[model samples]
Target: HDVTADDVRLAHREGYVSVEHLKRYTTLGMATDQGKMGNIIGIALMAEALGREIPEVGTTTFRPPYTPVSIGALRGRSVGSHFRPLRRTPLHDWNLVQGGTMTEAGLWQRPWYFAQNGESLAEAYVRETATTRRSVGLCDVTSLGKIAVQGPDATVFLNRVYSNAFAKLPIGKARYGIMLRDDGIVMDDGTTWRLSETDYFMTTTTAHAAPVMAWLEELLQTRWPDLKVHVTSVSEQWAGIAVAGPRSREVLEAVVSDPTIVSNEAFPFMGVIETHLTGEIPCRIARISFSGELAYEIYVASDYGPAAMDLVWGIARPMDGCLYGLEALGAMRIEKGHVTAAELDGRVTIEDAGLGRMASTKKSYIGSTLRQRPELMREDRPRLVGVFPEDRGETFNAGSILCAADNVAGLGEGWITGVTHSPELGHWIGLGFIAGGHGAWYGKTVIAADPVRKGNVAVEIVSPHMIDPDGERLHG
Candidate 1:
């Protein structure tokens, strides 16, 4: 607003002797003029107050757009849908051709569900989820964040950033790992494959791709400059497709150049292999499952993505397989109680998300010490658990509050993070966090209270792995 020499003097007396400090304390140079008209006067005043030369007093740094501009000029060419650019995967058009309904994941438009015979959203997803478990299903997972980490120190670097141990990870094997922020809260979780002694490939959730990459760069440049590691984002270089279901291996065996490599004894779960499809297109196959079924994720060059999709679809279709989408993928993961962004929100700790066992105790990692803070170690903190409707016919929405039977108001003890109609369990189920986890609430019922949506259903607490509590189906 209004500034004077007296104000500058007052700021200096208050120990704000620097020009930058004086400017902030006196609200100088922050008005409509942006200091263009008044900054020199303010500087002169500040110099006089300090009884020093104007140059000695120094001046606050100036940012660009030196002259004032109208809002219209600033908004040029950014109106409507053009406001933000959209990123598409290699299979974007192919998914649309297969009758896929698209939804936005970050800036990428991905298939939400592939409708058939005029099926509704619910109908389509249910059918897709069932078909996948019954036979085979192909899903586009190219949106996942792929990063290449190389050099001799890659292994040691990973061991420091990830909560789990990675120093001794065998080549040609992948391990699921979790990362924690400097504050000891969960940041992201993903699978990293040890391609060679000096090379590794990592896949992060789509939403955390860019941030995680930046975090890695910041750490290497500022925190551990001596470590011989180079990290690069390879997300756009490869197109990924997850072939899942009981017959997933059969679909791969039909197209892979060497069928024997797909055998369980040869490429067991969490195994990785660099192979070719149909004796031509180079690809990498990893035996990993997010649907709790026998599955493999095939990665091919971006240019060959369309061809890979066609080849896989041609073989899977005749075997009663279908093309599933994100909706169906969510259903299966929910059935198995897998955690996603909904559960790993920045507020939760590794233990809060039921991944405490994964935190390595042998070696110190990024968050190892901070994660053991007294407040974070409290047992009463919200812990991940499964929520099932007592009536089996009722359903609850994500963000619904879980409370005691008599108290349904306020934030309550916990809240639902995700919900799905589980085709495998033949009922609606949810993955949520409660005050004390399954051990404290098992065999007890809680009210799923959603005041805004007018939903209040009685849901029983149970283990998050509602469908396959054991490893039978995963190892199949």
Candidate 2:
């Protein structure tokens, strides 16, 4: 309390890992989530500590979302139809015309399938699964969370909050980061793209966009409130169309970009840049593909959605780029070993998501104390792991019991959180948590039983990363 802001800046220049820590030790940006409040003022003091001018120290950027919006405000009127932004396929209105039912797959609300008379959810899901597997069926992915984080402080805020480093990421480049609770558990995973040295855009789990944005603000405005930053949920301002399959890219090439448009090199994997589509509409295009192929996240003004979907489908139709439903995506991700909200939820830790390397040691942050507890540090803490059935007709339901055999045979070891009948793998596969995750248990056998699924089944424990076993697909 006796020390001045200049003293705090001096301590930081000497080597503080994060501005949040600088706030605690020197009280720099502790002005609520408006970190820049103190940051601007703090930097001035920091300059004084170094005998430099305020201009020499610099200032925060003008990012989007000038202030924090309440979770309630963001939710607004679409409590149900609007609880989330609805995903519509080129034929979505047609499906509604045919009395089809819809549900969410990731952030996209895709039609489960067309029912004849009295088909249950299970029946609908099975039919939808078959339709995509055999032939081509359309699914909507517009609901997938897409956000635009702008301003100079964009990269600055991203680097401090994420467990991974992103300060040096080049423009048009994207990086993956896992959000961690102070105890070093996985909270959320998302992709961030550096649009410019000062501007960054990121996407989080559809369910976590609000909270993650809030968390970012809390850091910039509160703990490290001096940092300049802005975050906006443009999830609805723009829409995303994901057309997957072996032919997705070829079909897309059919809808050629207008002249003066940046080519593939300008927006490669994790590439982020602004461009005009069809030679008119201004859009932000990111070379981000989640379909496990050469894909692009096409962003356009809300007004251009109908045209965008039609143009994309027109291209895909000839190449057999079936709009694989959410079901297929789920199957694809599970087989690829990626973890989603259903599997890792907020209750999970960084260890479970296989991201212990993201934590920063240079400075302390929220939950820093709880993260270091011995119990949490233990290698085996019900880490998120993949499971494969051992015998014939073996599959477990969500929340099914998991028992460790031979290796962690002490008691009921863990439980399955996400289960789906894999069309690709044929055998029922699952993602679940198990105690004693380290050592022999890493490759040991665990029995997963679901009373709802005709009893218990045996599954093998494996790493959470199911796709790109070697990171070939992501980089390629």
Candidate 3:
């Protein structure tokens, strides 16, 4: 009564050569439900009958409408605002109540801009940027990757993984480090804080968290099994708020129970301290800045994120500050000439990123040998640079190809990687890569052509550091 192994063998022997053919010849998976539950079993039977592996037997490609449905059923009952699945942060509801224009960041619905009454999106974001530069500003930066690394050989393990030296980094201090792939290209860059001799905390770019953790585990498991190192991702366990600007320390000192913990003498720039705020809220504050300002990032338990954000906002409100959003954050980093994943793009070498010097010559690292290859050290390699539109009003989109006016299309000398309207520069600025970089095209006029976006704009090549070339505000 049931289809036996002999049935499958008989079908294959009778010129039903393919699994798909065998299925159709015998109605093996063509029952009422149409093979969803039976297809794998049918495939295995066909493979065994033919004495071939499942992969060798191939799979049936199912065209759309896998289960036949009415046109109305294709369109679900949920529509309009309910169409897409939305993931929220701890401060999601609070951001909504504050009239934030929530948008998708990764999978999370984060506030893109908090528009006041009648304010345009441009006006709102520009105002946010200017306010952050002039005074204190708070941003929910919990989306960044956090991983706790510990074990007896943790320092040695980190030193092997990152380009910079970390074996002797003093406790309570954090240092920015760059990671490189085996091919000598930048993988990810972030700060690592030494908590103790055997403990360290590492932060990575938001998207690279899981991949970076996996890379570390693979290295330990395969390359160096004797090394005693362990890594655990803690991104979901904590929330991060970046409080940045000239008045950041003032706001921190006002709220932190132990003023000395955040004082200049005790916790200078790049210093990290774990302590509590008012209401005995457990917290860790790091004197780190992404806006090129004197800033500190406060970390707290995930459940307490909204309360921590509220506390910072309350203290910063009287200090002539505001709550900034993602737009402002992007603009500030651009002004600082910082290289984010957008600029790295997985293809650029550490040398091409202008961070080659940070790669240690004193010690061998993961990519050290590969990085010194002749091809990677070529002088004509595309390197990071800043582009300022000749007409300040003109904005260029990313993915535009840069070329000398005479060059043919698609044969670009370089390309724009990111673009933003810089409040500090009072113009549209972009970060990009160019062959024979930096001074190779100094003062030369080039055309940025976006065939896809149907845009072409003339731009002047300039030093990436359009804002503080001397690093004044960042260190002050």
TM-score for each candidate, following the candidate numbering: 0.86, 0.70, 0.85
For candidate 1, lDDT tens digit of each residue in 392-413? 9998899999998888878899
Model 3 per-residue lDDT at 416: 86
Once superposed on the true structure, which residue ranges of model 1 sit more than 4 Å away at CA? 1-74
**Stretch of 10 with least lDDT, candidate 3:** 28-37
Deviation (Å) of 359 in candidate 2: 4.0
Q: Candidates 2 and 3: which is better by TM-score?
A: 3
Q: Evaluated with TM-score, which candidate comes out highest?
A: 1
Off by over 4 Å in 3: 1-87, 452-454
Residue lDDT tens for model 3, 49-148 = 7788999998776645668567787788577767765557777777877778877776567778878778888888889889988998888888788899
Clashing pairs for model 1 are: none
lDDT per prediction?
A: 0.92, 0.63, 0.85
Candidate number achieving the greatest lDDT relative to the actual structure = 1
- Better-scoring candidate (TM-score), 1 or 3: 1
Candidate 1 steric clashes: 0
